[model samples]
Target: MLGATLVSAFSLAGCGEEKAGAQLQGPPPAPVRAAVLERKDVPLRYEYVGQTEGSRSVEVRARVQGLLLKRTYREGAFVREGDVLFLIDPEKYRASSAQTGGELAALRAKLEQTRLEHNRISDLFAKGVVSAKERDDAFAAYDSAKANVAAAEAKMQSEQLDLGYTQVRAPISGITSQEVRSEGSLITTDSAGSLLTTITQLDPLYVNFAIPGTESMQVRRQAQEGKVVVPAEGYSVRLKLADGSVFEQAGRLTFEDRYVDPSTGSIRARAEISNVKAQVLPGEFVRVLLDGALMKDAIVIPERAVLFSQNGPMVYVIGEGDVAELRPVTLGQGVTGGLVVESGLEAGQRIVVDGIMKVRPGGAVSVIPEPEAGGEGKPVAAGKEQSAGNGGVN
Candidate 1:
């Protein structure tokens, strides 16, 4: 019986030692890194999908009805205002102009003869040599001749205008599109049918975009709360091409719609972009980033620290005694290094930047403070920004 008791005691001792070894290791308390939040100005920049458009799009059409004799400008060529684009057969217009000219000349000669007769009759009436009816008849004939001459001159002006229209000229300087009416085809002045070609002015292009009214209102609210500072002038814009490349030239905000769209609840906005090289084409889709407003005294944190849950965007912050605590934060948008915390965060707090998988709410953790980023954790002295607001490069 004594031997049996000793064997049972030995077994219990061995199991206790195994449990103690496991407790000693304990997975090293889940090593994780963190960043300290500092209050500094963050640029309240925004990005929206946009489209490029030419500053001016003009339709090149014949102003008068005529047979198109030849196309003067090549298709897809650059043209200047008043440059002849097509030559309508000028024969008919020229002949009509000549006819008017000849009629005007004949009327002018007749007018001269009537003036002489009227003057002679006046002289005869003064001397009492002609009857009153005879003097009246001369005066009436002279007036008739004058009226005929005036009518002929008006006809001549109309004919001259028609002659000028025979040569179809560009109404605006721009890049011309393909010819819609080829040579030898009859073109007309009818508004519905008079599309000969199109010319688009792309030198100063426009980038059109829309922002939902709710977003705009929130920006204004933040500015009112002393958290945002809007520039006196306006925002500067940049364009991102389809291939994820940025356009070389910069742009400025020039137009804003007066009211929000009732259907889409979006406010229309436009940016005037420099296209001196004609690199941007009309109707091209792009992404527009606008900068100028400053989000002041903001808390920014790394993205990995943020965890998405059904409740909303939340993060695990290192609290007192190095314990991880769950924090629900509202975020505006993303920035260069991380996201700006709209609410539910403060300065000088530690958050997990990497090894988030090691973190859990209400649990003790090993502290690993990460090196402060240039702008994310490091506080900027007054006017000592690495650069201006988000309006410039990061």
Candidate 2:
């Protein structure tokens, strides 16, 4: 009897322990981070690797043959239009000009003397004081003097032009590269070489990038349909630098190529941006952010909230009472901040952003206080129960 009572008591204790375990609540809810959706204008942007180019570039070369005497401007300096960049040996040109002027003056004196003699001879011939041959000789002498004077004047003008060419000036206002040919370097007009320096305009810079041919057509169609919203002629564009910082100034789409490249099957597009401060430079790689097309009531979520599954891309949504529901979302193109969801999600929905691994479907949860809209801190949700409910949990 004693053995039977002990066995019964032990069995009852085991049952009680099992019942207590079943009634006990699960561990405290696992904390999770979440984000609330708000309806606003979300910009549709396509990013491509692009390079900055100067809108205008000019090569400063010597036009006349001479030895480079001095570099007036320092290399890698900003220059204005008509700024003297280099000084060729102007001594030779000056001498040539002076010689031409002297010759012209001498010819003028000769012409004046010959004209006086011709007048005298013509009067004498008219009065029968001298023969016609003398008058004809005087006329020929005057004409020859006049021709010599004209030739001397032409030579003088040529020399003056050559003297002007001795001073190499910047054709456009821009920043110049280092001198290619230093002082004392002999240069010629037909040397088949580049100039002393290169100047590039940086105030309004150009960005050149190539887009797939298919995308180019789509952009054009959208623009024609009035679906893509663009600014006025001087609208602003944003640029992403190589270091991932947003450029201060905005740019505008300047031009697009009409024909696609047969080899690459891409069309080139250019955007112009104001670099008044000279912050942006040529040949630097940048990412362009165009903010023309606005999607009305588009669904967006933090990129980290999205998860890839065998079924498709999905996100954990926090429904009423902070219950996390795994939702399959159709994704569109990705933008700067997040991915665009085409379907299966709506605006004003809350989605899990952090601590996503600790929750199951229909699990009781607690939502912690979050920062205000567009603020820093993210909203966090904590699950209260571990029980896997009726809904499938994957």
- Candidate whose lDDT is highest: 1
Q: Which stretches of candidate 2 lie over 4 Å from their true place?
A: 1-40, 113-148, 218-235, 317-324, 335-337, 347-355, 362-394
* Minimal lDDT window, size 10, model 2: 383-392
Error of 2 at 246 (Å): 2.4
lDDT string for model 1 (355-390, tens) is: 667667787766532225554444433212122122
Predicted structure with the largest TM-score when compared to the true one = 1
TM-score for each of the candidates: 0.79, 0.75
Clashing pairs in 2: 29-383, 237-250, 237-251
Q: Global lDDT of each model?
A: 0.83, 0.79
| Tens digit of per-residue lDDT, candidate 2, span 1-394 | 9999999999999999998997786655556765666555567777777899999998787889889998988777899999998888999999989988988999999999999999999989999999878888999999999999999988999999999999988999999998888889898886564378899999899999888998768766766776555445533468899889999988788887889999999988899999988898999999887676665555667677788889998888878866778899998777656887778877667777666677676665555655546754443333211222232223
Off by over 4 Å in 1: 1-33, 309-312, 319-326, 358-394
